[model samples]
Target: MSSPTPSTLRVGRRYRAKRLNGPYDAIVIGSGIGGLTAAACLSKMGKKVVVFEQHYTAGGFTHSYDRNGYEWDVGVHYIGDMGADHTMAKRLFDHVTDGELKWAPMDANYDRLFIGDRQIDLMAGPKAFVDSLKNDFPDEHQAIDSYMGYLNQVAKALPGVTLAKVLPNLLAGPFRRLANRKAPAFLNRPTQEVLEGLTGNQELIAALTGQWGDNGLVPTESSFIIHSLIARHYLYGGYYPVGGASEMAKTIIPVIQQSGGEVFTYADVKEILVEKGRAVGVLMADGETVRAPAVISNAGVYNTFGPLLADNAPHKAFYQMKLGNVQRSMASVCLYIGIQDTAENLQLPKTNFWIYPGTDHANQVDNFLKAPDEHDIPLTYISFPSAKDPSFAARYPGRATVEIVAPGPFEWYADWADKPWGKRGDDYEAKKEAYSQRLLEKLYEKMPQLRGKVDYYELSTPLSTDYFCRYSTGEIYGLDHNPERFEQDWLKPKTRIPGLYLTGQDVMTCGVVGAMVGGLLTTVAISGLKGLPLAKKMFVG
Candidate 1:
């Protein structure tokens, strides 16, 4: 073994102006899961691709960091649909990582929702999930059954919906219409509306939408499509990457290099070089121009259209119009906690805890946003990373880690956005400390044993998110998963600009798997007929 350096946790080579080996086939900006996936997929098809990341690490949100001898994942808490080898998510992951990345199944009781005094446990497997819910609300069995049926319907309708993103407008228009007709009329309706139509029980609706935090939307505002997708995704329960979230990029990078491609960290992309209305290359922050036939942006639509692409691009007006249709997602604060003892000794469960002030999720969120200090936190999500990842002990012996995530509007932290990280004045530090203490109290509410057991903890505000992730407003998920967001036709892989494409959570939905799937869809859209075999294997086989 080697001694760990400051850059030990980071993957990918450091960006240097002299290291340009292009005229590559594709230049992917942002080494997030979406960008890495696209580069790896294209590389597998004998294309020389290069990925540029502004962060010190490669994995945008998937990267894990070690601090004070403890490691914690930045964004990736858990992923779904990895239990079976034949699943599309599993297959794609295997293909990208060359079967190197592994997954560990979470507890059968994957999520525990604490709604005031009432507690609801969402178990793994369809039958078990329904049974558990039915156990809680015996009188609303019919509604539960109906909800499950809608999930099934959404699952059935998803392929066509995904296909439309890759297909041209001529082919996609008819296909999307057919797919829409096949799906339920209420499929794209507001989640709250759909659930209320099924049953008048507010508590049941709250319990059903407990996982709304997964997509950063309230039941009243989120589209039922996203609601159904997130619900169906975790029906089999959650799974953490076996070697930690960073393993995703660590393993995938090798596959990308197989075809002479590389993912570069600290590679700040200044702008997408457009010539004659075509994205021909990218201008680096260091004043180096790397040319490629294609330019794919895994950065969100705002970054691509607002900053990367020039203001005078051919489709500037069109994209600006498209941008008006969608809105940025949630900003949050995460308290990364480190425990001195081992996870096993500390008795931590792999099950995630979703603590809420009350059953009224939407109202609570609205109230909290209005005056954060006045009201209690709308939702507090607690995840045991050390317990979830089986290999944590081997990596960092006698250490355990926990992450507490709660919504924090960007406006609250806007004043400190321009301040350098770690030097944000005393007032900012005091605010973070206040929030951190409150979050610690919430954690102690469930597991009081961890009160003094916590060895170290640090709170990350929205400013930290903006600094690291480049989300100006510290939006966690790229775009809001609302009804309006889904209706935007421009949120697809292929953009109006020639040789320009979009991928990541913005293109599809949020979540690690969602963005990776978006990357796959972008590969298909870019490859056109050449990608059919890969598509058939993934979507068909």
Candidate 2:
């Protein structure tokens, strides 16, 4: 429990001069939050580590891309619980990186749900959120109150809820006793299934689950647990990184590197190096093998144990079986737009607006996939990156960035999955242009003033996501977070093969906070919570 010598924290910075090195303590594949958190925690524990990222920059899904002087978050638009003074997300980041990152709160309304023809804003704060919903269905006041109560209940039960999945029988005696069985009891139920028991109002339920697309679970498939987390996270409000999405990784990189670790982008791990049935290191794509005692894979389970392992890799079939059963989150078609006018001038709402053609959250994909032409796709998903972070405006004055995302089926770009993006041909271009126009028109419908002010825009299809982010099938949120996904005991930080571990979205839950918390789990597994687990830190920190 003694502090790691200050020298240990500086070891990674001057390893060559330290003259007391052996194998790296840990080798993390991918610099996503989960990986970074694990690396930072390991570093703090005096473990020299190295993180390898295949992309040119770190922050797997949380990274942002720039074009024409404007930047759009590739994945994160805003995060929640970061604003809470002692929130687990904030505490984990602060500890892992020694308080390096900064978070900015989003507008008052975290998200706007447009069902059928009505636009409903989900305001920040529990009371505000429930009040806003009350405006839509005045008669459901009791239901709204009941729902809010459940949100708070779910929040309190999450630690026990999650521990129930990972802790073995010997260590879980106390944890299981502390756990709220009433919480995970609902995990086996679908989001829609639970909503019905809570309320019978059809439209109200649709608005609540409008953002289920983020989790790749329609109301019918998503777990009640996941649904409550997302809705409640934003109930307090959403917070974007002050410097945009890249800051999410940038702030933590120095902390990771300071802990005798390195964060390397553009260093692809060609294979997971194994020795005597345990992970020992990673062979980079360029044939360079970096040795380490342990490996933490932020790459989703499908890629970590499925694709990266060797021909006779131990526990390969077990992971393969898990992959065969778990559903993947939906891929998306994003139109990244760099507008010449300031978002302020456009009077753009700080809260994102998710517009759907109808109120059937259950039939969202069925309509899109079955009748792709008439599908209406979640009409529009509006995000203003400029509004989230004004500092980004200095990089591109007089310009604003807007990104629209919608569900895109695998079939849309199946032919070009292996081909490069821009080279995908005329059909791809034509389809992209049509979808982009549809989204833009919806944007125009929402905000009529900024019709022709778009400076430049381009579509990033599933092919682009795959090429850039290295997702196996262009799935955005790692594995699909369905009701069944949470029930799978196999999805945790530990691995069947010793020294091999998992991280990223698949570990905890999903979202930036969820993924980072997942990294926290891996860190705990690596060093036994820095010799001071949460119980001790509750008073010690």
Q: Look at candidate 1 and give me any clashing residue pairs.
A: none
lDDT, candidate 2, at 95: 77
C-alpha RMSD by candidate, in order:
1.3, 6.0
- For residues 1-541, what per-residue lDDT tens digits would candidate 2 score against the true structure? 1322322211122222133244689989887878887887778778888888887778888777665556778888778878865766678767765777787888888898888888888888877888888987899988888777777777777767566544654665556565645554554578898778888888888887877866776888777888888887777888888877877777777777675678776677889988898888888776677788789999888788767998699989888888787887888888898877777887776788888888886576687788888767654678888888868666567778888888787678787776665687787788889888887888888878878888788888888778877786788888777767765667878888888889888987888878877776777666654534642352124
- Residue 129, model 1: lDDT of 96
Q: Write the residue-wise lDDT of candidate 1 on 1-541 in tens digits.
A: 2323557788999999878677699999999999999999999999999999999999999998888878889999988889998888899999899999999999999999999889999999999999999999999999999999988888888888898999988988898899888988988899999999999999999999999999999999999999998998898999999989999999999999998898899999999999988999999998999999899999999999988878898897888888888899988999999988999998999999999989899889998899888999999999999999999988888889999999988898888888899999999989889999999999999999898888899998889888988998889898999999887877899999999999999999998989999999999989999998998888776
TM-scores, each model vs. reference: 0.98, 0.92
The lDDT, on a scale of 0 to 1, for candidate 2 is: 0.76
Q: Report the backbone clash tally of model 2.
A: 1
- Model 2 ranges off by over 4 Å: 1-22, 165-184, 529-541
For all candidates, the clash counts are: 0, 1
lDDT of each: 0.91, 0.76
Candidate 1 weakest ten by summed lDDT: 1-10
